[model samples]
Target: MTENEPALDSLTALDSKAPPRRAAVIINPAKSGGPALQGAIFRLCETQGWAEPLWLETTVEDPGTGQARQALEAGVDVVIAAGGDGTVRCVAEVLAGTGTPMGLVPLGTGNLLARNLGVDITDPVSACYDAFNGSDQAIDVVKARLNHSDKEQVFLVMAGLGYDAAIMADTVDVLKDRMGWLAYVEAGIRKLPGKPVKAQISVDGGEPVRRRIRSVMIGNCGRIMGGVEIFPDARIDDGVLDLLVLAPRGRLGWLGVVAGIFGRNKNETESVEYFQGKSAEITLEHEQEFQLDGDHLGTGTHLAVTVEPDSLKIRMSI
Candidate 1:
């Protein structure tokens, strides 16, 4: 086995001293580690003095919220989300406001939340151990809804509209598995060459502002691919959210955005603009795709989003 992979032959609940510490793990079977990952799970729990984690598996129909609630009902001290950002959002959404801490094991394509929280993904065993032993911190959560959709979804990292959403919707699963984050680069190349969505956006219930944009990213945690900081001032525990408007651009405009992203100072140039607010409402000229934490939420002409400060309790060192 590789150094990162755990080697466990017979998985069993370890006999431990004193009262057992209880934890629950909600796992997505389709993710990278697959069934073999369970060995690591059992081994980690065995060593951590945690009980054989009230194991719950996510199905194609149910991602993890229900199982997480079930775990909470059973009085688990921590709820661990063992999938990608989507799964993390699901479990976290349910655990929000309950004062229950949620842990993450980065196993999906974009482990954005885990990365932002400083989880060790290269070593699965270490990742699990970190989740089990981490300290507590509360982070902000955003709730978003598309036009004609009555249901609202929760996102922990960032949410987007237009080009960014298209990249997430169009990225192929096999390509993502084979190329990792390079898959997003390839998909962005394809999507960025297209037209930007024209829309009028209003922040914090303010007057409407019109702009033709490549993407509108609302970020709770600002760090993204390649260690680039989209909004340098954005903080996860802050009461507000940061807004980035990536405008219509050709090759040169793309270069300007790249420069702005890598540069130490913020650019208030015509190509990109930044704003901060507690809520945002957008009305699109036409149907544009929407995404949250890298998962597409379908096309919508109207969008509404709001931030809840210190909304979710997270189990992490950061």
Candidate 2:
């Protein structure tokens, strides 16, 4: 079957005897469209016969993970994550391996995952319709354990250490909102002068590979915002992660790397290295800043990341 072919067996497995009448929407009110969007969601759910639609708002401090956990605990048939990539990642982390399907309602600056899944970022009503009628698809999730002496935490989607993370940490919130995806380019230019850090990385069962790198990105799915395929071959449902290493030698080399990334010729760039692996371990020379799904997570010395194959069920437009 083709990639777009709907799995008849999976659709038949869905309980069609009765339409799903209960749903929980975990929304980030701070995101764009706020109350108006939430109201629309309520209307959409009601239209779908979801009389008891539970609405949960994400707090500025707690994010959506806690809310998603609550939604799952409430036994809702579908859990809709209404926010950006960070919110989606948090909800996916909780819903993974639980046989609970996740629905996306993109409402952030960069809806990377939504674009990857062929989701309609605009038209919340249409998006919700797809959520209600779409078949379930199993997708891969990247689980990262950031070891900072005593503390550890898991990450989903994309994880970055060094240059990319530094750019994320430094990017001003106002600029991000105003400039959208262009903010990353401005931040990247500002971060180009920093010295590369030496690190030891082990891919799958391979021997430790040591190199001086400007940045390292581990991606479960290909592409960033604006359809830029960072890891062109990366698949969300595949049981592997794409590891991208950048070690530009000079200003011209860095531009070349950027060109390659945008041109979908990552392997052609001399300053960049790409690999696919089930797991990876990175031991930095010193503590380095990192970001998980665009959210900065301070500094860490040791990072261990693995791909959880088909761990999350997502409602996709067939």
User: Could you report the Cα RMSD, in angstroms, for every candidate shown?
Assistant: 9.4, 8.2
lDDT by candidate, in order shown: 0.84, 0.82
Residue range 1-318, candidate 2, lDDT tens digits: 889988988787774656556778888888878788777877877777676578898888878889988998888888988888888878887898899999988888778888888899887668777888789988887777887344344455688999989988888788889998788878877887977788998999699888888889999888786677888888888898999988887777787677667765556877888888999999898778989888898998878887888888888687
Model 1 accuracy (lDDT, Cα): 0.84
- Highest-lDDT candidate: 1
In angstroms, the error of model 2 at 77 is 0.4
Q: What is the clash count for each candidate, in the order shown?
A: 0, 0
Q: After superposition, which runs of candidate 1 have C-alpha atoms over 4 Å from their true positions? A: 1-18, 249-251
Pairs in steric clash, model 1: none
Displacement of the residue 58 alpha carbon in candidate 2, Å: 0.7
Q: Kindly list the per-residue Cα lDDT of model 1 for residues 1-318, writing each as its tens digit.
A: 788765454233333334778888898888877577788888778887788878899987889888988999999989889888889989988998899989888888778888787888777667777777878888999988889578988888999998888999999888998998888889888877777768899999999899988888899987886566787888999989899888847767876676666655556466778889999998888888999888788888988889989988888655
Worst 10 residues of 1 by lDDT: 9-18
User: TM-score of model 2 relative to the true fold?
Assistant: 0.89
